[model samples]
Target: MNAVPFRRIGFDIARDVLGKPDILLLDVRDPASFERGHIARAENASPINLGRFLTETPKEKPVLIYCYHGNSSQAYAKAFSESGFGEVYSLDGGYEGWATANARAAAAAPRLSETLKAFLIAQGFPPDDVNAVGKNQMTPLMQAAHLGPAALVAELLAAGARVDAMNSDGSQPLWLACVGDDPEIVALVIKAGADLEHKNVNGSTALMYAASASKAKALMALLEAGADLTYENDGFSALDMAGSRECLDLLRAAQRRLKAAS
Candidate 1:
């Protein structure tokens, strides 16, 4: 049998803790220690319950593990690697090192308001921080889609905002763009990799929104982007939601095309 390989990352290099969407932060410390303070969004899964934790976490996602001083974390990291995790890392100095360096920065990094967001973006703020959620769990990109200047939406997308990020209502930025009836914004989001088939809490998709709102250009863009025509929400498909004759015609044509291809 061979030992699994994993990386050991120092506090300095691990500064972008929450930036990666697929990175899972695991704090394998005592419950009391975790309760006192652990990294933001880090899950506490003590060694005693390691098996259960591993079962719940996705093996494909990168896992960063930390313990009291770092020794215990190495064992956990190795365990994750051996269990088929693609990327595993042990924090070099563990929680003590991170807290000493990042506590203040993390605490001070407030969610930006739309006005402040615009100001900072104008001043060249990093786009990766666009994931920062504000009121109603709306990411900066979602806010931009809602408030637009379509250019701002494009800027955020260029900065690597996750196009599929859902708001409190499970509405993604693409859905909001459709709701706003901004064809340009809808196109920008689709170009930036928005999920055309993403459904909200009510199971209504962006295509449905575009059709219902009579957004001809947006509906056309979605169809071109391969939005699923057969997707039904609460028994209503995009074709059923088409409010205008033009929208209905487009959806029907698309449905026929898809049916023929299948």
Candidate 2:
């Protein structure tokens, strides 16, 4: 009984909805993930609560729904819209987008720090162009993901930097986050939609680079993001390049789970 399709909105639009009063902000993630972190004032769509929400909340109210990576929320949003709720919307990029959007809001400084700004200028990039191509054909965001204090990365992302932007070799920002071995930055770009399955011109993925470089935290982040444990670069899988016993065990366990599921 679907009517019009629900709109899928980015964080920017969601932020605007948040500013308005009486909007219904719903998080459809499992209870544990919702407990870990969720947008302020977001209601978890547990069974009993969802039933109550549908029958009780006024259809005049705008509804914004979100799930893990912004995928699952769409179904829920459609259901709501079909039920005749006006202004129903699904969040694009889900909880990841929400987390990064909050971080960006909190990271609002006047501009890049004097040191980082000078460094970017010295490297021949305009500090104000967050997406300007620079050394290695990298965007400022890619550079910051590689060289992060988290805030700089957040700020650049706030300025509309693309997480999916790739250099000539097709290496996304996520690849450089692993090279920089910064797990926080790795997670940041991931939430921002860094492609897990992206294969560069060399057939390498961020997961492969993380394992090869002995970047334990970055590797863990990729695994948690559900990266394919069986990915290979010319027959050299991440397992072959694992730098430590801990990494090896993680890859093996994840691989086993993937096998078991299939």
Best-fitting candidate, scored by lDDT: 2
For 114-218, candidate 2 gives per-residue lDDT tens digits of 766765686578655465565456777777788787877876776667777667677888898888877788888898887898888789888887877778888
> Each candidate's lDDT (Cα)?
0.77, 0.80
Where does candidate 2 stray beyond 4 Å? Answer: 1-116, 260-262
Model 1, residue 98: displacement in angstroms?
7.9
lDDT: worst 10-residue window of model 2:
127-136
125-148 per-residue lDDT for model 1 (tens digits): 433266565556566777778667
TM-score of each: 0.56, 0.54
lDDT for position 160 in model 2: 68
> In lDDT terms, how accurate is model 2?
0.80
Please give the clash total of every predicted structure, in order. Answer: 0, 0
Evaluated at residue 181, the lDDT of candidate 1 is: 67
